[model samples]
Target: MHRQYVVNLSRIREVERRFKGELFLVMDDQEQTMVPVSRRNAPAVRRALQI
Candidate 1:
């Protein structure tokens, strides 16, 4: 699909939930996912994961 957002998807938390707490995204096609948000660094999560 190769889709991307340029208008700033500020509601990235919703994306985190959609994947059932998957913090990391697959860098390779044959890899597991991640729940990019953490309770300890939730604020950073927003910036690091580009929320």
Candidate 2:
């Protein structure tokens, strides 16, 4: 089944530190996922999230 999750942009943490690379970290139900993103396209992601 296909499902969709609505994530709060404010809740997502953006990490740009060394060894981590550029990513959007989303944590829920004690589980977390790091979504890789490019610096050039970051603004688009933010816009899509309505942040």
Best by the lDDT measure: 2
1-51: candidate 2 lDDT, tens digit per residue = 002444555666553333544545454434565545566665676577665
Measured against the true structure, the TM-scores of the candidates, in listed sequence, are 0.32, 0.42
Q: Tens-digit lDDT track for model 1 on 1-51? A: 012312233333233343544343323223333334444555555566566
lDDT of each: 0.39, 0.51
Residue ranges of candidate 1 with Cα displaced over 4 Å: 1-15, 18-29
Screening candidate 1 with a backbone cut-off below 3 angstroms (N, C-alpha, C), the clashing residue pairs are 21-35, 22-34, 22-35, 23-34, 23-35, 23-36, 24-34, 24-35
Q: Whole-model lDDT, candidate 1?
A: 0.39
Candidate 1 to native Cα RMSD, angstroms = 9.8
